[model samples]
Target: MKNVKARYLFLAATGIAMVACREPATGKEHPPSHHAASITPAKAHNVALYQFAGTPPAMAALIQKGIMTKLKVAVQLMQGQPLPAMSFYKPRNRYIADSLLVYLRGQRPAACEKIIGLTTRDISTRKGEIENWGVLGLGSCPGTACVISSFRGGKGKVSESIFNRRMITLALHELGHTYGLPHCPDPVCLMIDAKGKMNLDEGESYCAKCKNKLLAQGVVTK
Candidate 1:
């Protein structure tokens, strides 16, 4: 268990999915390479954690602690809110991570650098253009918001610590997107393509190159 600094690792679909999307894992999403990694420090960022209707209080508390301890940024626990009565849910009953992201951005709090919506319900996003994939989460480059689902992580018979690590990994990966970090070339980095919820368990928080990118983008301190 290395304290990965971050790249995304693709899943091989080898084992039983505790909660998985329908999309196949592809390991080719990252950029070619960054010859000169930026070390120019940007100003500090403010991250807001929002709890959806079904988020478990105990789990949310642990995630908040992990964000503050690991990322070292200003982490604020915002007031709990409910999803608007809309079509964010698909036929499979999983919520749409992209739809939630749109809502969060349109109504983002003032001065919030980035915001992550955590929920107990399962979430998914688009795979190609119209097809849906049962993703653990999703976000955008230099975007204002992202969403993560704990229901997928809590599906299996795992310990509390492993579950917490999964949430933290998902959090940092989406946060990386907000800093404009693409997937990393490092096979074992946190920035690698996340295929399934279990895909996150295999990589370090960040690989050397991805860590540099996070540093360059000011997501991680040098």
Candidate 2:
């Protein structure tokens, strides 16, 4: 009798441990997992590109091409839109990236699965203790909207080609965030965090691990 009781208790404890391992606590900022994806109905992935007034048409086309080829997602180029004056931060002389995302989300067309706003204006978002912290771009994890800016890429008199490449890098990074990918540890991965340093030149492509994660989520093709 004593041996049976001990065995039962051990089994119960083991089962509890397994259950705990299977279900992590969910939160607003939690990255989506395969378990979450399983419950949601699968849908085709499509991206929409929006060129804000003042951004060059050539630059937007470059970014659109990158998304289409690398991400394997259909993209639609929307009509040019004016930048919202309310998003401008006079003190920083930059636009608020968070506000731009909200605007993009609201403006997102029904046919598009995700929307990205492109601009040449400097953009900023709150980071930790700093208000109006400048960033190359910003996006919501596992969300439908993102925004990128080329103002920082043109700095330091970089060659136009290099500057354009940086913009493409920024666009890819922000879009990766929208696909629920966090900063990758691989130094050369496109998803690597800028960490306020703007080292776009270092990123070549998504690391294998990051790409596999996207593959599992069906965001990237094999």
Candidate 3:
């Protein structure tokens, strides 16, 4: 795999706006049923969080809390299953993020309005000409499921505050996609596209326009 830092700088310098927290179609140009019929604005209340095996408990709790507080939704920690072996790309030693979304949606309960998968292992998806592009997270746009990983965010030298912020920012960003929010042009918005860079610190929260959109969708009360 290409070095993460180098790829980030390359994309940032090129000003290439790669999809952030977006999953390619579950099938050929069509999302899966769960994605297609995800919870509506008013129904987006309960969320199921799957802590995939090997993910840290503290991290999972933090994610759950972050989502609950930021999105103003109920988050329940469900039983975590093993990451699908089929999603693993042996050569890169990472899980296919799109496949992981499929797995996560399948595991969602009927009662939960949405679902998220958390893991420590690396996850990736295709980006432009490059196949198996590593990503911090991937969420189905206007769909029900998403996945995030700590492998990339926790790498290198970072303070605990920065690391925690990165994790929380990723969770909120992916969930924002599921709530039908697109990548925001505002640099400080939580929904800003990463554009193939590790600039989580640049995002503080949802911008006013994005927050108003979420408010209209009933995803967040405040």
Candidate 4:
């Protein structure tokens, strides 16, 4: 058996991007989902963020605006939807990340380039080549959907200020994948894997290398 690289994770109080599975960061091309549907946008930068019913609304609003301004994208804070029970993991009392992806795929807005669901529930994926428990989030590239959970950021352990930073960092990290970016080797870059040690650091913006790639791909102008 091939040795799987173990990603380090912080002890978050509650919660969780990327596909349910990840290939090694050796820059190999993984096949795209042939039936994956593209999301249309009201404008080039339009991004739709769906807040699942149980998530904290106030925090979600703040995240919506932050994403809009920071990434130079137009983020729409849509009405909350009840998380589907079909995604529930009875043992962990968490939802399955892929189920949310499947849900978001069907819920894309006509004027949005990507659709992301925000929830407070813990989420996980059981399909990685190696066992993965309690993931921070998951996203698929060239797909219109992704999701993030604030449940695991270790409630009350993180100061309001730092909590916000971590949320935005992971938000952009997963969103970057939706724009077809891979996990960056730079520890301080937003594209670093959330489970990486770098996330425990204070930086929240994309590194220059990633910023230029986004510009080149037309995912972001600024």
TM-score for each candidate, following the candidate numbering: 0.75, 0.78, 0.79, 0.76
Computed on alpha carbons, the lDDT of every model, listed in order, comes to 0.67, 0.75, 0.78, 0.69
lDDT of 3 by residue, 1-222 (tens): 234223211213222221222322456664456666664333437788899998889888888888887887789898697899988999999998888887887898776767899999999887878887999998866677888899989655798778988999999988887766778889899888887888688976899998997787677877
Best prediction by TM-score: 3
Task: Please list the residue runs of candidate 3 whose C-alpha ends up more than 4 Å from where it truly belongs after superposition.
Answer: 1-44
Per-residue lDDT, model 1, residue 211, is 72
lDDT of 4 by residue, 115-139 (tens): 8889888888654563436766777
Candidate 2 least-lDDT 10 residues: 13-22
* Model 3 error, position 196 (Å): 1.0
Estimate the TM-score for candidate 3: 0.79
Local distance difference test, candidate 3: 0.78
lDDT of 2 by residue, 1-222 (tens): 223212211113221111001222355565767797557444566778999988778888889888777787777788767889888899989998877877887887776667899998889887667877888888866567789988778655998778878888888888877766777879989888788997899985789998886787566787
Deviating ranges (above 4 Å) for candidate 2: 1-42
Regions of model 1 farther than 4 Å from truth: 1-42
Provide the lDDT at 79 for model 4.
78
